[model samples]
Target: MGSYQDIEGQLRGKRKFFKQYSKIEVDDLPDDWIDQYYENGFFTRQTGSMITKKNAGEVSILTLAFLLLSHYPNEILNITIATSDFGIIALKNKVLREANSPPLQLNVTYKPPISYLSTDVSIFNAVKTGLIQPHDISSMRPNPKSSIFVEHFADGSSGLHETVIDTPSFVQICENPQKYTIVF
Candidate 1:
């Protein structure tokens, strides 16, 4: 039986370790860290999707997951893509199947949209009138630096391939559907 002080000290050490670990940059990771992440699995989040076609926004988001994992190889990762479109999920499943990767846990949840006060009425009107495309709205578009795809894949010089779906390591993880514990 450890003393209360002993337990507290252990927890404090763990907190400090995690704090430092979270601050690690991609360049700081070990040379083999990406391989380790592929072997151990990692987390990814796609908050929303605007398109679900094969070569559309959903694919970009999925690709972003790979780019993010590559960028943050120091962290443990899980994949959570939240969207109203079933097609997005289906595409994920298809990719998983094609890749033959390890079983990945997934949960599907639905939450009703929350109403919020809008001060962007003029912007909305402009879009409705076709005076400005939705993409033309600064707020509607994500900041370039903030996007994993834009940061790592858009330049075609990142050395990291954008077509992560074809990667054998990713494909291997998709192979084991029986290991998946999906919740709806």
Candidate 2:
């Protein structure tokens, strides 16, 4: 998560995305991690302020569940969601009873919930469904100054992480692959 300005500026350039999206609709999540949002739909605030990519991670799990349900309904029998979001675990336990139940038809093999999940589309969907809070409303934003690399590991191969050279788009892959994911 970049600064709120950075996030808005980038999203503004791509206004087309908002046409199909809303920034305010939030998941009626519980502020108390122990109480959980899925069961109550609302909860009193306990933590100082929920921040980071927690909301994003929660949203992804919901989206993944919905997508898998609709896209591959008949073939799915079970799904093992892999995430580190408390919200995901909450929903999985409350709505899906994740541990004991399977997908309606297609069997998903996702890792179990972790504490710090990477922001992705699956989490985005959970936000859309009101399972997580809006990203901007949260108090924390990831520091872009600290270079983070997102590498895709697939097919028994390790992809490389590269340095960020420019920032009109917050980050642009370095021209030279040898630099790794460095800031300078």
Candidate 3:
């Protein structure tokens, strides 16, 4: 019972995110959302202009997707994705693995894509793949203005929301947690 308008709104959210972060022109956005980029490797005029091939090589759209969705917890709860890329798949895998081991009780759901996802590795992996260009990832770290607390899992694992900080890393953070905030 969902209307195309609802879907468009979500896509619009993505467009707004691109505009806000990348500083691309809103009037120059492409009409089609997912299909346009998925089919034609070329991004829109403004998008392409802002994100040079070199900068594009450094950004990952999947990372932007995760960050954008994190900001819209409500919309993510209401929607469901048919399929997702390896970045998302990887998050689910890591969360599930953590849940099985003792002392690493990650109270998160993996089946529903929106409920569980967080990690820098997934972001990096998405960059390796052609799913997203480098310009899509945000340069700004989460909770940059404040001190962020991090918890690391077994064997140097990571997730979308969990910022893993070890003893040595924690010491480095303690020096200036706010300035050196890893994630939030």
Candidate 4:
């Protein structure tokens, strides 16, 4: 996905698909992937920050859920996106609408926002410490030079892994959806 100007530059001919919708067709995209224009109307820059309030570029929660279901068609998946953004929270209504629509059946539940989430705190700290650079903030997968140590299980298996925010890692995760999950 990209800005309208970017999509226009990539198009072979001057033609728009789903003109009324926030989507377009790009010859460069994978056959199964939908090419959507980055809708600036749905996002805003955060105060005193280079990052946008939406954070995850053009990736919508519905798209993430769809990718998950497509990757694990045989399994029952329970996907949840916790956020303090009211715009994202409002998407629950859209989720309900799509859930009731034909061809896609989804069972969705909405919960009240938690007062605080530790993960959010960690992200802020990471950004403040320069572990997550400004350029990394909007990337599909921010490959930072820094790494973090993580213990997998009681098997004593542990190692340092590249520090990446999963939610914005849509490109990498889409290539292997089963190997990753969207954390936002």
Top candidate on TM-score is 4
What is candidate 3's CA lDDT for residue 161?
A: 39
Instruction: Point out where model 1 deviates above 4 Å.
Output: 1-55, 97-182
Q: Write the per-residue lDDT of candidate 1 for residues 1-184, one digit (tens) a residue.
A: 3578976775676456445534566468679754553332322223476322233556556655544554554462465665433345455655444333332222121221111212233334455566766555555422221100112234443332222222232222223323321121
What's the lDDT for all of these models?
0.40, 0.40, 0.40, 0.42
Candidates in order, TM-scores: namely 0.24, 0.24, 0.19, 0.30
**How does model 2 score by TM-score?**
0.24
Error of 4 at 86 (Å): 5.3
* Candidate numbers sorted by TM-score from highest down: 4, 2, 1, 3
Model 3 TM-score, 2 decimals:
0.19
Task: For model 4, give the 10-residue run with minimal summed lDDT.
Answer: 109-118
Model 3: residue 2 alpha-carbon error in angstroms: 41
Model 1, position 165, has a per-residue lDDT of: 24
Winner by lDDT: 4
Worst 10 residues of 3 by lDDT: 140-149
lDDT of 1 at 55: 37
Candidate 1 global CA lDDT score: 0.40
